[model samples]
Target chain A: MDKKKINCLSSAISIHNLSKTYASGFVALNNIDLEIYHGEIFALLGPNGAGKTTLINIICGIVTPSEGTIMVDGHNTLTAFRAARSRIGLVPQELSTAAFESVLNTVNFSRGLFGKASNPTYIEKILRELSLWDKRHEKIVALSGGMKRRLLIAKALSHEPQILFLDEPSAGVDVKLRRDMWLMVRRLRENGVTIILTTHYIEEAEEMADRIGIINNGEIIMVENKAILMNKLGKKQLALTLQNPLSTLPSELEKFNLSFSDGGKVLIYTYDAQQEQTGIPELLQQLGEHGIDFKDLNTSESSLEDIFVSLVKEK
Target chain B: MNFYAIRAIYIFEMSRTWRTLMQSIASPILSTSLYFVVFGAAIGSRMGEIDGISYGAFIIPGLIMLSLLSESISNAAFGIYFPKFSGTLYEVLSAPISSLEIVMGYVGAAASKSIILGLLILMTAQLFVDYEIMHPLWMITFLILTSITFSLFGFIIGLWADDFQKLQIIPLMVVMPLTFLGGAFYSIDMLPEPWQTLTLFNPVVYLISGFRWSFYGIADVNVAISLGMIFGFMLLCLATIQWIFKTGYRLKT
Candidate 1:
């Protein structure tokens, strides 16, 4: 293999032709081929039951795929399961813990499950980082929801895995926990760990992901650099505040796709921002010709949320 | 063999036993002691001796075996089942540990609990009746073998069951009834005609007869055949577990 091929082969994870069909005949994933680069944060964006969890479970070896192969750092997941699995850590979507177990012991036990020796200092560091050191001796049943979620993260990072998958990390979490989780995720990324997270939270992907892959109905519809995707698909909205509130949009401005908002005090025109001509100039000229006067005007570029909605809605 | 991983699971499970000391350890011991008091002290004294051994002494091994079977299955089954129920099995599944290690961890801890419970019940039984082990080494062998075998059986039940009620069904409905009919309380020799032939077909008879023989130097069946039966059952359970892991039956998709 050439140098570039070697580099691709050395990627954190490479999945080829992966597919899964449940016993009940539901196709959860279909021919998914993906390469996650080392030391990069990759976000899988999908709707509910879009096969995000299925794909992650397959790679984690918790769910068997009906067909295809997966390699983690050049080890085949099926044939070299232990080696492949040793490199990965999965924080599942479920908020599960051994209810009677102390937090410290639980996390320590998780580290040992990966064959790591007991390192109390390292375990302490993780506990402190997650702000769980104070509750280390408490049973899991006594912890609040947010604390339990953090404990899950502590357990995932206990063995210091190179590749981490956070399945819906922010689901049902309070804002503070979500903020802390993102901060910790960024810190992990900075330390050269490859992070893969699945979420329907567009802003999360916009803030944390370097690349975004959109999955829908057991298929990868698109994968692109986060910046490129937003720039390419994002739209711009031109909002004009009218001097007089109109009961309805006049047919004279029908050439422009304009809509009335805020009791007709605002005229909103949405256009593709990526186009060389956004139709703003023509809309303005037409508005002047129609004798429509505006007291104030503002232009806003579409957010990642808008781009994500348009992409999914297009399907 | 990933001893650390095995130790991790084993210790976690063992700690759970400690956390539920009353239910896991005390309850079985207390229940078995009641059997000794009711059957051994009150009824056995009136029933006279069997095969030159006191009736109270005769029932000791069978009573211990009874508790051993039920406790082993329940402990092992519940240990693995709870992880599955709570979704924590995903962590173990995704870890670097192998199937053998997983089995050893859970089955080992569960067998240890049953053995300890069996021993405690023996100590409790001594308070009411005097029973001696004719072959102390063989007695320990049978005790360990029974615990491990039934623990393996329970592990399968844990995997096969999708709900809590299903977990209890086999132990309560199947194993318990089989143990009662397996000559635990009475020897097969006391049965008349075809009943003796039919009792031989019950697998638990061999387990109880073999266990009782280890206590009194006498058995309802040949000692070799009884050992063979238990070992055969062990192999069967082991094979079933191996297949379950290979096909990723309930553990996987």
Candidate 2:
């Protein structure tokens, strides 16, 4: 391949104004624009029925869109499907391996699906990496759920695609396997493979994603760097235990956006993390001046899940 | 579509079907044998010979037709339908393989199973009665043509079916009735004039009659007309299946 082509291949996938609507008049995906940077872990976060799978389907060329265009490594997905699909590997949400087929054959055949010649050494390495070498000759039906999930990953990576799409890779997986998958994903990214993942587990996205895109109602609500999204959208809470239970808040404490909780025994303050001078010290000083005292105090920062819920609810 | 991808899918389908190998290979052969014993031996003994061929040999073509028609449609339809119902079709559709590759892999396996069953019944028939072949080439031609035609029909049925019940509706309701009424057990010539004329509308009659002519060198209907009917049905099936693929009919939604 030419160097220019190789360079183009590194930039993986680009989508512009893509949309999909079923004939039943249900719009599964709205006009969505996204670009997955080369060699990065990009997480698509959405709740159920939010069009994450539909977006993946459009990118993989499995479902045709009603409008717009997608380019995989600069190859038009519609006209140059073979080339576009050859560069991308998709591990679908369903476990679809042939039940009677041996693990080795399943992965080897998936490699051949993209017109790749046999490379037993490469396949062996993939199986070994996925901890499937011991079960190489075992039929898929005999494998456990985690083993089946690993087999799906092995199959996807067999073709050595530049970009890999994992649609909810850990939906039903155990904690051990989920961690193993995260490690494997990190390794793949290190090897210069771009990964686009859709996940309902907020922590999975927070732990593994370099960037996060939130999709809702068939549209992308926001896409931001992990740090930036958290800093810009996250909130902080201050809890103050009072010396005495109060029936009502003091008018002076109104500036702290305070609320009573724990049967009026505690006062809570909510503030944006991105704002300078959260004014906690000033609030406490004012409370002391008012002859009010807190027996205990603590603060809690917002999590990715909180930000995600807020964003979805806002839309 | 690439040949490697086609081969991969073909091997996958064959592996999946291997679990029911006994049922797949034995059911049609056993049914054909029972037809020979009950219809050919018991019934034919009283009816005597027709067109100078023994009653036992007279029903050979019809028995083979029954196996070919039923096995061809069920094998193809069930093979595709199970994958779709089990959600494995999503894996296949998302793979790099094209629609043509998917069809070839499935239809090829279906045709292979139907041909094997057809040959198995033919061999079993040899143990009870011997049948002469006037045109060996035509015998193979009609067998393959019927298998392809019915396999294509089953493919369409598979695509159209959304549930397991719907998948079986075509074979149980349509195929079984058509095979019985299309003169699979007796010659249409034995029927009254009006019934014989109505039997001409049955597509399986043309297939069996053409195949019987290949074996006995004589048929109730003109061999040319039978061949034309079979070919016409094959073309219609091919056009419809191709349209389904092009439009991503049931496969997409």
Candidate 3:
């Protein structure tokens, strides 16, 4: 049996031991394995130079991998590349388009290149969905940055691919545009199109991804359901403003490992936010028993941004 | 195998020719006419026939070969290079179409454009002086073969070039010089001694000779050798292209 040739029984994309080493000997991706299930919005979260685009390009067939086996929709990326590629469409991070070609013509060209029959109605639908139908006849050079981005999405969706990759789709997008793009992504997912988007924006992933995969320094550090990941990695901080400044803390309250700042004006305790017993009430009672009194108290829960920053910073 | 993809690329490239009609189709005809006037009407009328064919008519095929070579190279080179430069080639590279299909689309369109331009120049030659294509079918064959072969060569240049200047280097510096010296304006047989043997090493000589043979049934080299040279060059280009896709050359990294 060939260990490298693993079956993708249920994975939309199954990557096994993927690694890409460029001619310069720089390892862009190293010993990575990931699986994206069908009909889900999977956000690949990573920072600058984090191999997000390299991974997307490899899966999309633009960049070849030095070592790995990638199966796209049950087709091997190397041996059955045509089948694999036909099933996927990629909206690259760069804003590349033909300046002289019209918007509609470019979409039609993309569909044809992907071996799809010409469908004017489908092209029009995607264009209109992306708010590009009105500018269809205009030369791409005349379009604004936002319209051009929309045109890229239109072209990617032109072929009705089973899997779509959006590499930093929201790089230069506005709030409204981003909202609309997400709406369209939702519509695609509703139609059973698997979407794997790469974004450094934690908010984008938090709002859209069903599952989140955090990649850092050419490796995937974590993959989990969005809610479970946030809950697990997130932190909660309890801050207490003392009624009086204290020169020192009593050893009875030391068990909580609490720290004081602002000249002992505030005491802080950090704990896992996801745990059923956060020890918050016990800590408060212990402080009370230790004769520590606070005038007011506040609590803060970490966002996905904090989790992402901590993850990358740790790596 | 993807006929639709091939048609799409071919139509896209052909439309570009239409958009730049002045530069693509018209300019070549205007330049070839100048060649017929200076080299044909001016010089040929003052000179005697070579191999019993009039000097003006003798240079017709060579003159067309000159433009065909340069046009085929530049057209295909620019067709692929511009996409690479502008970064739009990612879609095509990521598309399901095979490497062979992409080559067929680009080289096919470039050859078709050169063939049209070559035929137009052949027609323009009629206004200058009288001539006859002794083997009309062979004339079409030579025109097509040369266009396709040179277009394949140009596709290699496109893949090899990283910058716009590099793209022009082969067409302007290398191919142009070769065609001019490869018996386009004069017969290599007219050369003296080892120079004539040296001229045979220029592959363009065979192309021009074979193209001229189709016109006047006179050739400096055997027609079979000319065909072999063009086919041989074409096979090399094809193999290079295959290696390019296999290695993920400039197109991938």
Best by DockQ: 1
Per-candidate clash tally: 0, 0, 0
* Cα RMSD of predicted structure 1: 2.7
How much of the true A–B contact set does each candidate keep?
0.86, 0.48, 0.91
What does candidate 3's lDDT look like per residue over A236-258, in tens digits? Answer: 99999999988788777777788
At residue B191, candidate 3 shows an lDDT of 95
Pairs of residues at least 3 apart in sequence or in different chains that clash in candidate 2 = none
Residue A166 C-alpha lDDT in model 3? 95
For the second chain of model 2, what is the TM-score against the true structure's chain B? 0.95
User: Per-residue lDDT for B1-253 in model 2, tens only?
Assistant: 5888888767766665576777888877887898888777777678868888888898898889888888888888987888777766665676667777877888888887788788889999988777888898999999998998898889889988888888788888988888888876678888998999998888888888899999998787889999898889989988898898788888875
Model 3 misses residue B72 by how many Å? 0.4
Ranking by DockQ: 1, 3, 2
Worst 10 residues of 2 chain A by lDDT: A1-10
Poorly placed runs, candidate 3 (over 4 Å): A1-9, A241-251, A259-266, A286-295
lDDT of 2: 0.85
DockQ comparisons of all candidates to the true complex: 0.85, 0.51, 0.82
lDDT of candidate 1 over B56-90, digit per residue (tens):
88888888888999999999999999999988889
Model 2 misplaced regions, further than 4 Å: A1-11, A96-102, A241-249, A264-266, A295-297
